[model samples]
Target: MIKTSLVLFFALLGLNLFAQERPTEDPAITYANTITVEDLTRHLTVLADDEMEGRETGQPGQYKAARYLEEIIKGYGLPGVGPEQTYSQPISFISERWQEIDFVINGSSKRHLWDYYAYPSKNADRAKVMTDEVVFLGYGIESEEYDDYGNQKLEGKTILIMDGEPKDRDGVSYVSGTEEASVWSEDISLKLKAARRHGVETVLILDPNFQRNLSSARKISLDSRMHMGFSEKPADNYSNSIYISSETAKTILGSSYGKVVKARKRIEKKGKPKSVSISVDLALTQQKKVKELLGENMLAYVEGSDPVLKDELLIVTAHYDHIGRRGNSIFNGADDNGSGTSTVLEIAQAFTLAKEAGVGPRRSVLFMLVSGEEKGLLGSEFYVNHPLFPLESTIANINVDMVGRVDEKHAADPNYIYVIGSDRLSTSLHEINEAANEKYTQLALDYTYNAEDDPNRYYYRSDHYNFAERGIPAVFYFNGTHADYHQDTDTVDKINFEKMARIGKLVFYTAWELANRDERIKVDVGVKP
Candidate 1:
């Protein structure tokens, strides 16, 4: 019995010593330390060069960028997801460029690109020609208090409506919010969907605001818009939408304009919907040049060491796309995303090096360079919807956008970074980030842009929003907007490489903690800070 007790005590002592001396150094930290400013500059030089042509979505520039990323990741010995044995995740896109538009009201030809403007809708094919009876629905709003189409038969009919919702006598909007317009007024998509639900085949939004300002029409003409959903074709019974001048509405109503205006005022004063029928014929003809294109999101991963935890994933993303070019000017988006992209490359390499050194993290990390982010987060949205890994297994996302330069807010204090959505879904995630920063790359981790009500809406603007929307914890690293943001002046010379490397290291450290932690970060649904 004495000999057995002595053996047990010795074994316990050995176990304690083993626990205390367990390498004392985190290999993930060692890997993160490998990320360097020189490597970041080297990658950025190639990515943001003028020859790359701004890395526009679905364009040659973006394709080249995708291929470059794929080759780099492949070189790092990272394996792709499927049988393709490549890092490219192809996404299909349909591009629409409007050529011409003709809108006629009551046999009187309306001016094109002046009195009314029609954009190439995903709902329209190569051409869309519609001749239908017009109905004037005041504001075209349907609410519990008042229904505009309560007893109205609007099937296959074109409805003309105002831009804003109703207001009380005091001029305060009745829907919600005091300073800004309600959701109904803010989102035209909501109004369009509502109009379609009421069996309205077409909608003409008459706004005095858009009439004089030809900016919207100019933008639509300048850029070819891409859409992912094909069901938007008008031939598929989708609603046709157009924005017209108030003058067009007046011309359509003619002698009944006074009565319509009176009804509008009455509705605004009474805080109710006033639906009216006007005898008018409306005709719309649009011509579009269509092109189908393919885009790709570059995805590469480092597998975890622990067999059980290898299935869990953490994603690091940056959009490698920007507006291609406008005439002679190239909007070289070096700081916009090239910085973030290069940083991702370095972080990925660091992890790869660590894995080769036989000290990989416990959970997997996916390095994604998504395209179509400039085109409304298309690639990220597609990934979330058709994810290679189950979203439930996605532990968190660290998104980097425009982290190279110091913005106006941080010009004096250049070491600061706009950290958004850290506490949005996970309290533990935020704590990990704070601790990582305190220990490693001591960045001024700014949370000013993290607020949901922030005007810039940084949280919703980046690729991380797609992950967050799917209940995954996401944090966006940003350097706020500068004068050169989305402009031709945003070139490589303007990028602050040292500051960028620091931010990159911060992200790597945060990811290191997340990937090496014993358990997944606990999601804090209530804390949105």
Candidate 2:
């Protein structure tokens, strides 16, 4: 009996020592592991399915997707942060489409898409303007270096101007004094501002690349566009402007067309302003249809355990919208954002599970699955403009977009993600992400798209940009674009589930550190809006 008792005691002692030596598993890692490939695949399969109708904002498929997400988050026991404690924040906007536009010069009607192109103006549903004489403003540029308006009385006058600024012999712009185009050339709105300043009622812009511009503009003009319904009407905004081809300008300018071209050349050489008056009979008419539409941004939150820190929020975002159906074909958008939405769902579940188990983060975390991302980041834009929580209290945003498939750059090595705008706002946030990836995911944190000069301009392309613009630190995780991006071919079967789960784990681990940390991540950098 003594021998048996001694043996049992020694064996128990060995087990206790082994337990002491082995470090306790971190609850963060424990919960992060729950974001498995199976869960990601399962969530993505439903979101990217054809029945969801591509999840276009304000459409039936989008509502279905929103309901599915609401159900999932509600099932996880997370509270809704939206109005009336509902999972949805209702967003109302105006959808406008141009129906018919007529331009007549000297009683001869011009073609709409061939001779000119114009977008629906918020000013009026229908407009008619008649002018017997049109002012010719060379380049329509107003600046200290060169002024096109030069003491001209343009009040209620119709003006015709050429597109782009004058470039010198060495191909340097006279306005910017560089090879790069200035705001006058880059943003047509600036030129319109110049026209509006002069009290011009109608502005005709002559495009050198009219055919190419019209072709591209035609694609978008065929589709209806949405804007905030409460915003200013078109009449309250800038003057009515129309883009016209050289042929249209020739009809309007008559003999003055050659004189206007010579004026542009003279200005390019002498760096001076030239203005002329052209006598032409013109009448313009535009008709548009505006419809009010409603969309939703699905929001749910896990309140922090600590009282003081719970007030400060961390946001995790993903856009659940895609380009809707085209005829019978559907743009499933599995990799474009279905992957991102699923990752967010899984992350939300993991956080909820952690909270239920009494290991929640110290800072509140809000999970936002937004719509209209494919529509122009409208959902996120609306959220930042009309936030449920104080924008000042929001600490950081972590956005996941397009994290499913391998791009051509990573075909040989698929274990990588593009991290954008992390170091843009906070060095601390960027370091935290790097540390999380190093310790847990170990996936290649590629910053290929993070460069300020990156031609892709991806930093400003996604939903995270809305938060970043509001001085909030943000990080965007992406798997990069594939051949199937934004196409109907972006189906669920092409997703790299293992890679997606790893990215989700990395996001969770990063969020874990950010939320539980004693101090909020400092914004050491300035935001350029």
Candidate 3:
């Protein structure tokens, strides 16, 4: 009887074992597994090498970087977007240089570097020599209430003006507010634009402050000769803008300088418009060269499997451009963006592999390798303004920048990553990220730089800000600032490849979840300035 009972117990245990089911596998984990450290290092090895020449914007090095990225995505079998089905988006810009500046006021023969300075107009394309009657148009501010050049014959003429708008008796500004001056006074471009709109051939701005800093201004003028401005389409207005000292102004105004100075004081005391006429022959000779530069923003897309959900999109971005070489020392920004650029390529490969294996996300993914990020996020800005895909259908942007090296704050902690702008426009995005990290990567998601008042202003610094400004939720992956940031020392030997891979996997998981979730992540948080 004991043997029979034991046999029956064994039989019941066997039945229970057979009836049990295997646990379901998470797709996010499987897809994220494709991002490997070896792959990231291999790509970074080529991208951050000295041969790339820092990937400067509009330079041959930048074009090589673009080709490398284009070929990379093409290898993944991702197709290009739009009718042309090309992977490159063209961006035309004007690079200006100050070739020459010759000015003679009342035969005094003002010096260039010592007494006066001038720069080629932003829209200047050819050399121009202007000889016109100089008219003192006060501050040259024109608006509904204040018109300094009102009804004045300013067409085909030169205008002399002063810096800063008219202030009240208490030094308060009515154009802006009681405490601060308006955009007219603070922004030089606005002042120049106003002068050009008046059909003025030249604008001589009497800037005492600039004159005091003439030494610094001369250095700045030489450095800024290669200033670039976007010119894909036609733009209006060109004024040969010059900044002169008070002494130069006096020489041009002759005996009328004292009266003009007194009138300026009166306007400051009473907050009134004081437009005067200065009779002087102004002649300027400037040899300007405006070279049109063509830049390309790389784009490639992987189609989603789900019929209905495939319309929604997720974007991954990283800038491949750097500060270029200063002299012979190359600013090889390996960690600044080379790490992020490699991480993006790895993420794209992982997504492409998942799609091929029939475990792809429901939503499409667009990989963008942009240029001109170091120059002020110009590539991403252009993308958002003129997107290949509809901005509305795009749910979020995952931007990676400077994720290779550890900063002072994270030196002691290896398992850390800087998470910015995750909660700025969407609470759901923040929660999803926390859940994904907890489930997969346990790296500490530091929000130190996410504070609205954070001095670094990390949110507005990266390419993600462009999407966030358009109300699309974004997450910026960073390792915080390091000593070698923006320096020539940010080399490939310094990047933590293992840590970079972990962060890349974390991004993959987030994108995977965002792309395949039952519903899109809701924009539930208010955007911060």
Best lDDT goes to which candidate?
2
Off by over 4 Å in 3: 1-24, 95-293
Model 3 residue 438 lDDT score = 96
For 1-529, candidate 1 gives per-residue lDDT tens digits of 9999999999999998996556438665667767888888888999998888999987888988888888888889888886666687887667667667677776778776778776665346435456545677888877665566677888878888888877776667767636456778876766777777877877888877874567867676557766564324554544677788776777877877887888888878777667667777676777777776568889888999989999999999998998989998888899989999999999989888878777777899999999888888988998987888889999999999989999887788898888899999988889999999998778898898887788988788899999988889999999888899999989889889889888988999898889888988877676343
| Per-residue error (Å), model 1, residue 372 | 0.5
- Model 1: per-residue Cα lDDT at residue 252: 78
Candidate 1 least-lDDT 10 residues = 229-238
Answer with 2 or 3, whichever has the higher lDDT: 2
Q: Which stretches of candidate 1 lie over 4 Å from their true place?
A: 1-24, 95-293, 527-529
Runs of candidate 2 exceeding 4 Å displacement:
1-24, 95-226, 230-288
Q: What is candidate 2's lDDT per residue for 100-182, written digit by digit as tens?
A: 77899999999888899886643355578899999888899999988888888999899888888988899998899899989
What would the per-residue lDDT of candidate 3 be over residues 1-529, giving only the tens digit for each residue? 9999999999999877764432127766766777888898999988888988999988888888889988898888888888899988876555555667678875546778777886544435335454636777778788765668767778778888888887777777756647687778877777777777878777789886875678766775576433334642213655667788877887888877787888787767776677667777666777755666567788878888999989999999998889889999998899989999999999998888888878887899998888988878888887888889899999999999988889997788878999999999999889888998999999999999998889999899999999999999999999988789889999999999999999999998888889889899888887666
lDDT of 1 at 210: 77
What local distance difference test score does each model get? 0.82, 0.87, 0.82
What is the descending TM-score order?
3, 2, 1
Global fold similarity of model 2 (TM-score): 0.63
Ranking, lDDT, top scorer first: 2, 3, 1
Q: Model 3: how far is 100 from its true place, Å?
A: 8.6
